[model samples]
Structure formats: C-alpha cells, structure tokens
Target: MYDCIEAIKQRKLKKIEGETFLVSEKHILKARNGDEYVGLKLKDKTGIIDAKIWNNLLHLKDRFEAGDFVKIKGESNYYNDNWQVIIKDLERLDEKEVDKSAFLPSTKRDINKLQEELLGLIDSVKHTGLKKVLEEVFLKDDFLERFSKAPAAKTMHHAYVGGLIEHTVSVGKIASELAKDYDGVDRDLLVSCALLHDIGKVYELDATTFNYTTEGKLIGHIIIGYTIVQNVIERLNVLSQEKKLNLLHCILAHHGEYEYGSPKKPKTREAVLINMIDMMDSRMQPVLDAKIDDSTGWSEMIKIIGKSIYAPKKAPKELL
Candidate 1:
C-alpha cells in the first residue's frame, strides 16, 4: 500500500496492488475497430491518476462503482506524459476490509478547534429562539461528528474533509462583523443563517469518496436545507411567524437566483447579505487555494468562478 501517489514513479515500472479509491469509471468504445474498454480514475489520499482495463470489460463493469474502495492488481506506466495504471484484476472491498481514512482527502484545519469555534459562535447568539434553534441543529453529538467531517462540495471550493465546519465557522465570523455595519439588520438571524446556509451539504456530499448521494442528486442542498429548517420550526414552535418565514427565506434564496438553484430570490436585507457572504467565501477560497499560475501571474480561467484569478509574482531578490 502507498501512503501517497506522488511518491510513485513511472520509471520504476512496478506493480501497484493495494487499496485505491474509485474516483470514476466508464465504458468506452474504440472508433474504427469498435472494441470496448473501461476507462477509470483512481485516487488515494495523495492524488488521483487515470487507469484503464483492456480485458474483461463486460465482467468488470458492474463489479464496482464510483466512490468505492477497490483492491486493484495493476502495473504503473507512463502514458501521455502522465502515469496511468493498466489494471489486470480488481475486486471491491468491504467496509471491514478497508480503513476509511486512507481513501479520502481531508482539510488541514484542526477538527476539534474548529468545532469549538463553531459551538462558541452558536452560543453567542443573544436571541433565545434563534439560539435554541441553532443549538438543535449543531449541538447533536452525531450531527457534529458528521458536520466536522463533511465536505462543502464534491469538487469545487472546500471539497476536502472537515470543509463544512471550516466554511461555516469562517462565514459566521465574517457575517457577524458584516451585520454590524448595516442598519436594521437582524444580527441573530443573519449570523444563524450564515451558520446554517449549507446545513444540508453534510448530507449532500458523501465524505468517504467525495461524491453525491441519492438525496444530493435528487433534491440538492438548498431545498434539503429549507425542508430541515421548516421541520425544526414546526416541532420547536419557538420563533414568531415572521421570524420563521424570514429565516426560511434566507436558506431557500441564499443562492441568489433561480438559475443557480435558489427556489426564491433574496428579498430581505438579511437574505441579500447572506447570499453575498456565501458567494464571496465560496469564490474567494478556491482562488486563494489554487497554485497554478500559467506563467502570467494569473490562474487559468476557472469556469466555475466565471473568471481567472490573480496572484502577484514574487520579484527577484536583486530587485528587493
């Protein structure tokens, strides 16, 4: 078993047989000859690499799936300037046979520290009704464990483990300060909304293999989160009708527009602010994390963010 894929070498020409995560796989046919093969992507904690199965395509197609723990028998080779695996045999691994930590990428942030900060923010809310609701959402022992390990997205910003809590704590802190600058903003609602905006994401993204679950693909996090909030309100019966309506509106409309999956547009001042805060954090984090400079001091155009990002080059020491 390899601790990291980056340590593997193409020149060595060795067989790699151990636990590798199945990032994706597909059936493809050759154009002229009309022969079939399975194209696949495999990952470890370090990185992912392309792979292919040339034989037994029909037999292997249903044996595993995306986000599965696969025990592979393959040889590493260089192809198209990258390392690819030519798999000879493969088998799906049961949960008992695999270590869950080896196949996933996690956030570098300290999990316990982030949880403490998140709880502190939840405790700081002065409004009794809102505070109680936040507690019910965040205080559950099981939910905290999952939230602290959940990814914010499958591929985009904050995709690693523990990303949800990292993002939530950051947005809560910033939203708290941002709310102070505006007049007539409900601080409690804004801060709580900031904390709860992506609640459903914990369920939306599968942490083990960083893929979408059935609920994630069917309903998405926005609607899923809105429904959860509605249920909590109904059971608790704490907040007034107006406060409940506004809180639900922020969660439903946080995406800002229908095209982006928000069922409603942000109407109230807090809703608009919540949307802005969410957008800024989601956009800025990915840009800051990117290291590809394209030799021009600008990152390659990331389609998801809508524009290329800038990072200033370090001048030579002579200039300094």
Candidate 2:
C-alpha cells in the first residue's frame, strides 16, 4: 500500500498504492503554466494532509466532492514544513469497499474491556434506587446496542465508533477515584453522572456516516441527555427531590461553562468534579490517538495539537 507521505515524491507515475480518504476541502486554481490544478485537503483516521493535482490527465474535480472518499496515486514531498502529495492517479471508491474504521480515528484502548469495567462500576453502586435507574437505561436492548457502537462527537475528541463508551468510562473512572479523596462527592452519584453525561450521543450522531443528526444539531447532547435522565427518573418512581435535582444538575453542567455548551455552570461539588473529569478525558484523546510510525517516531507535532512529542528513548542495558 502507498503510505500517505510516500505518494508525494513519485511524480509522473501511473499508479501507487494508498488508502482512499475524504476530501475535507478542495481549491481548484490555474497555475502560471496555464494548466489546471486542484488543491485538496485529504484526510483519513490517522490525520489529514495537503494534496495537489497539477496534471490535466484526469477529471478528478468532476468526479469527487468534499466528504467523498477517493483512492489516490501520488508522490510525497515537503512544502514549507508540511507534507503534501502530488497526485498521479485517482479513483472514487464504493462504500462497501471502504472500511469505516480506516476513515475515523479511535482510542487505542480496548473498547469491550473498558465497557465491561464500566458496567462493573455501575453494578458496584450501593444506592438501590440509583442502581436500578442506571440499569434500566443502560440495559435497554436497543439503547445498549446503539450506545455500544456510537461516536461521542462529530469531529472533536472521541469521534469514532465505540468512542462514546471509551470516553464515558474514562471520565467515570477518574470521577470514581477522585471521590475517594473528597467527602462531599458521592462516589456512586459521581460515577453515574460521568457515565451518563454523554449517553444522549447515541441519538445525537448518525451511526452509518458518523455525522450529527438534525436533533443533535438543533438541540445538542447536553439537553438530550438531561431529557433522557429526567424521563428515566420519572419512570422509575424513585429518587427524592434533592437527588433528582442534583443528578440533572450534573448533566447540565458537565460541559463546565455555558460557552462550552453547558446550559448551566456546575453548582454541586459532584457536578464540578464530573465537569473537570470530562474535560480531562476529552483533552487526552487527541494525544492518545496520535500516529507514530517506525521511521517517524512519535508524531507529536500535530497541527491540531500545536506541539511535538518525542518518543521514549531506549535505556542502556546496565540500567536494567
């Protein structure tokens, strides 16, 4: 297969192996030579790269649009500290032939194991009514299936299949551990809030294309989650006025600030803790998903991250 960077250097070539990627952006222009060229921002799960088509041999502009996947034959080259590809050959690909996993970045963590651990934490909750309510929502056959497969966000942070669960579990674990250090924070409540804060994402995102739904775009996940939790609280016939209000507050304030999408700022200690943990988990995802190749070492200088990470160097045998 043509690795992305390798394609930019082999100009005047007929074909090269490389994965198909979505054209996130396209700019077609006329070069000084009077030949038509297309500038493209191509992206896959690993990351995005700049690509340019200078030859007039192909009608790529007519065939592909933004968000459509295209297999490209190109040579890799550097331009102003960035890697780019010079297109040599290209073809639009069928949906069935394209692996969705290859198109979306994912957490390096094992999803199934993380999910099971999260469920076990849910089971450990000592509060009878809270445990029952959580079980009712999480154990629903349809919701469980969809939640297990959904993406947490459209493009930010955890945006891949099973990403919702990974992020929730991470936040839940952090909140649970922090509860041990503080007396005001209820471990069960904090963990439950973290796990369910983004549960609405199952409805917020379209599973097939991994894009936001109309409701997701219009209402947002926080409101959707609050609605679901309120419905569950009403259906369960449990939870006192104080407990119910506190739970809702956590969901509403998990985004931390109004500007960040939280309708209400965190009020309760549990809500504050949940918000902090959620932010911590979300920020760590980009670093965890960064690509490192055998030759490239740690690819710390992600344009999105704005910093470079160095791989851990090997130690001398004497140290061992």
Candidate 3:
C-alpha cells in the first residue's frame, strides 16, 4: 500500500489516492496571494516526501499534528528536481487503523546484535567504578528497551528505530580504537562517555514521533544525559571526585563548542576525543545515506555539511 510513494519518485504514478502516510512535520505558511497553506513532510516505510495543501487550510490544519497518521489524496509533482505531493484532501487516522511499522524507518542491522555489541563494550571497561556506572545505566531492562528503540535524532543522521544504539556502538568502537592509538588516553572514561553521550535522546525524543519533547526543547540531550549520569554517580558514590567531574564534563562538552550547545568546551583529552569521534560519526552518516542526484552522481546538498557528497554509481561485480 505504501509502495506507491516509491512509485511516485520513480515517476510511475502522478496522483495518489486513499493512501495513508505519517506526518513527520507540519508548517503553516502564506502564499504571495495571502492564502494560507499547510506544508508537510510525509513518510512511509518507502521514503519521505514533501506535501502541500493549498486549499481549505483552516479545516485541515487542525485535523492532525506532526506524528499523526493520515489518509491523503494528492498528486505527485516535481519541482526543483525533487518529487513532492500536492495534497487535496487529508484526514487523521486512529492509531489502531494502520500498521505503525509501515510508516517508521528503521535500521537495517539486527538491533539485538547491536545491543549485544554495546553490552560487550561495557564488559571491556576495566575501571571498577566506571564499569559499575555503565552497568547501572545500561543494563537495566527498562532503559535498554527504550535505548534500543529510540531514534538518534528527529531529522539528522541515524534518525530511525535502533539508531541510538547503532550510533553509540559506532562511537564506542571508534573511541576504543583511538584509545589504543593515543598515549595517556583513559580508554575507560572515553568509551564510557561515548556510550552514554546521547543516552538522553531516549527521553528527549518521543518514542513514536521522534519529535523533541518539552524537556528536549528546554534542557536538550547533553544536559539531560549529564543529569542522568550525575544521579547514578551520586547514588553509587564510588568514583573519586576528580573522575566524577571528568565524566560529567565529557558528557556536557561532547558537542565541543559553546555555539554548538555544549555547556562546556572539551577541556580534557578524553573529552576532546569524544567530541571529535561524535562529530565524525554524526557528519558522516548523512553523507553516506544521502539520495544521489541521478544526473550529477552527487547527493543532494546536505545543510549540515554545507556541500553535496560525491557518490557516483559503481559497476556491479561479476558473481562467480
């Protein structure tokens, strides 16, 4: 049923009817003629498309919010080299009416296997107090369940089910390898902070919508993660004051710069390493996943990196 979205992109269909899509975002705007319109980012498992409702905005605007599943009638059109839908009619559907998974994008990797890798990384920690903190933070079933399912972000890289753990494991592996390469690096602290860095995203983003929660808009993931880690440290009271501060500092400064929402800048070697690795993973993901422009063999311009990624098609290998 949702496959038509792909067909729209492939130019196999020009109009859509009786199709249901998830509203990932919604915006109300005015045209030059001063008529209000509803703009939306619609998604199904196939992919996401932009949609606009230029008529009857007042009636349709309030019918659904971002994250609601909606049935829609629209025509597919291309403008500025992108495929989008011009919606004519729309109605919100109850949650029970649709398969939730049909609209949510998910990681291709085995989530269970990724969780196992995270647990394995935690097991490799040699610091007694840090190891305890990792176990207390991640080993709990409730937290594990949420962390395993939550997306890494709303629209940025790894923004899908199981994205948080996928990103975490990636950063953890990078930090682990870097620790081995660099002298005087605290592998325990670097790896621990890497795994814990974005843990707050589980709460920051709604489980189903992947939208920012009130707390996320106000406190953000860095501070939320810092507080979560701080509470665990206080309860345990096993780490030395120095280590505790350093651990929390790493979380608070992981974004690296104040302009980037980091409460503190990376002051220690471990914190610097965490920041770089985190940036590396975050920046690279979108480039890797970008939809390449067929004619240019380059990806659509990525706002985060301020450039398009060169991704020419590769010839298929001969199968023996």
Index of the highest-lDDT prediction: 3
Best TM-score goes to which candidate?
3
The order by descending lDDT is: 3, 1, 2
Error of 1 at 57 (Å): 3.8
| C-alpha lDDT (0 to 100) for residue 260 of candidate 1 | 88
* Candidate 2 C-alpha lDDT tens digits along 1-320: 22343333223232446657766667878889888789887766655567898875466677776667788877766576566778877888876887766666555678778779878878988888789878988987777767877878765677667788888888888887899999878888888898889998988887645557889999988899999999999999789888899899999999999788889999999998988888877877767665443354554344445665644345346755
Of candidates 2 and 1, the better by lDDT = 1
What is the C-alpha local distance difference test score of candidate 1?
A: 0.79
Candidate 2 local lDDT, residue 185: 80
- Taking all chains together, the TM-score of candidate 1 against the true structure is 0.79
lDDT against the true structure, per candidate, is: 0.79, 0.76, 0.87
Which candidate model has the greater lDDT, 1 or 3?
3
Positional deviation of residue 298's Cα in model 3 after best superposition, in angstroms: 2.9
Q: Native-vs-model 2 lDDT?
A: 0.76
Cα lDDT tens digits for candidate 1, 192-281: 999999999988988777778899999999988888888888889999999999999999999999998899999999999999988888
Q: How much is 41 displaced in model 2, in angstroms?
A: 5.6
Candidate 2 stretches with Cα past 4 Å from truth are 1-18, 22-58, 65-67, 75-89, 101-106, 292-298, 302-306, 315-320
Compose the digit string of candidate 3's lDDT tens values, residues 121-176. Answer: 99999999999999999987699988999999887778888889999999999999
Worst 10 residues of 2 by lDDT: 5-14
